[model samples]
Target: MKEQLVFATNNPHKIEEIRRQLGDRYTFRSLQDIGCTEDIPETETTLEGNARLKARHVKSNYGQDCFSEDSGLEVAALGNAPGVDTAHYAGPQRDAEENNTKLLSELGDRKDRLARFRTVICLIQGDTETLFEGVCEGRIATSPVGHGGFGYDPVFVPTEGDGRTFAQMKQDEKVRISHRGRAIAKLQEYLKSRSGADRPTG
Candidate 1:
């Protein structure tokens, strides 16, 4: 039987991405699956802190071994203005379109479009906590491109890919190079090692 693992998130996009990446090895459950309806606190000022906060909340309240991730788009020209505030950059509504518009408006006519997407994952199992981080360097597009992804995907073009924005790429294509993907890869490695170590002697 696959080891059951909880992912502490209510966002379907995040849940889908993580499930696609790690579903083969483990049984995945979301916050709703465990009946966590309250909005978990995310008052952390840093990506890692926020991720840790969510993971700890689930583990403490639900007594489940779970993981949580926080992602942000940091634009160099903006001095990473929305590093920790990526979700609510425009306002507290967390509207992606509004956030994108605000980002573009603030970045109008700027030549420097260098940016990066960063993801931090915090995993809690029993009393042990582990963190993993991944970064994808890229540039912010002047306008939204495709509609394949959520949040900043429509305006983010990864350095590892062609000029197309993340939203223009297929799900598998994007996942292979996304910051979240890289972090998930590291998590899979760690989970594999843990599984191996927990196995009984032959």
Candidate 2:
């Protein structure tokens, strides 16, 4: 039987992306799957901190092997203004279109559009906590492009691609080089070393 791996998230896009990358390595569970109906607070000021916060919450309440990820877009020209606050860059509403507009307005005529997406994943099992990080260097597009991804995908162009925004690429193409994918890859490596890293070590 596949081991239960609690994936602490309510976002279906993220859950699907991660599940695809994870393959058949383990059985995945999410917030809805586990009846965690409330919006978990992410009161931290940093990506890693928020990731840990979510993971810790799941472990405390569910007593299960769980993991959480936090990611953001860092634009070099804006001094990384939206690092940890990428999700709420527009305001507390966390509207994606507004956030994108706000980012574009802040980046008006900056000339240097270089940026990157960074993701941090925190995994918890019992008292053990582990962190994995990944970064995908890229540039912010002049405008949103494509219709494939969520969040900043419409405006982010990875360095490994042919100048198309992340939203322009297929899921398989994007996951192979995404920051989240890279971070999860590291976690998978660690999991492999620790007996395939799944819950119910039963």
Q: If scored against the real structure, what TM-score would every candidate get?
A: 0.97, 0.94
lDDT of 2 by residue, 1-202 (tens): 7768888898889889888998886888898898888898889989999999999988888777799999989999988879999888999998988999899889987789999999999999778899999999999888899988999899999999998999999999999999999999998888887884554676
What are the root-mean-square deviations of the candidates from the true structure over C-alphas?
Answer: 0.9, 2.7
Compared with the true structure, model 2 gives a TM-score of 0.94
Best candidate (score: TM-score):
1
The clash count for each model shown is: 0, 0
Q: Can you tell me which runs of candidate 1 are displaced by over 4 Å?
A: none
Give me the overall lDDT of model 1: 0.93
Which pairs clash (backbone N, Cα, C closer than 3 Å) in model 1?
none
Where does the lowest 10-residue lDDT sum fall in candidate 1?
A: 21-30
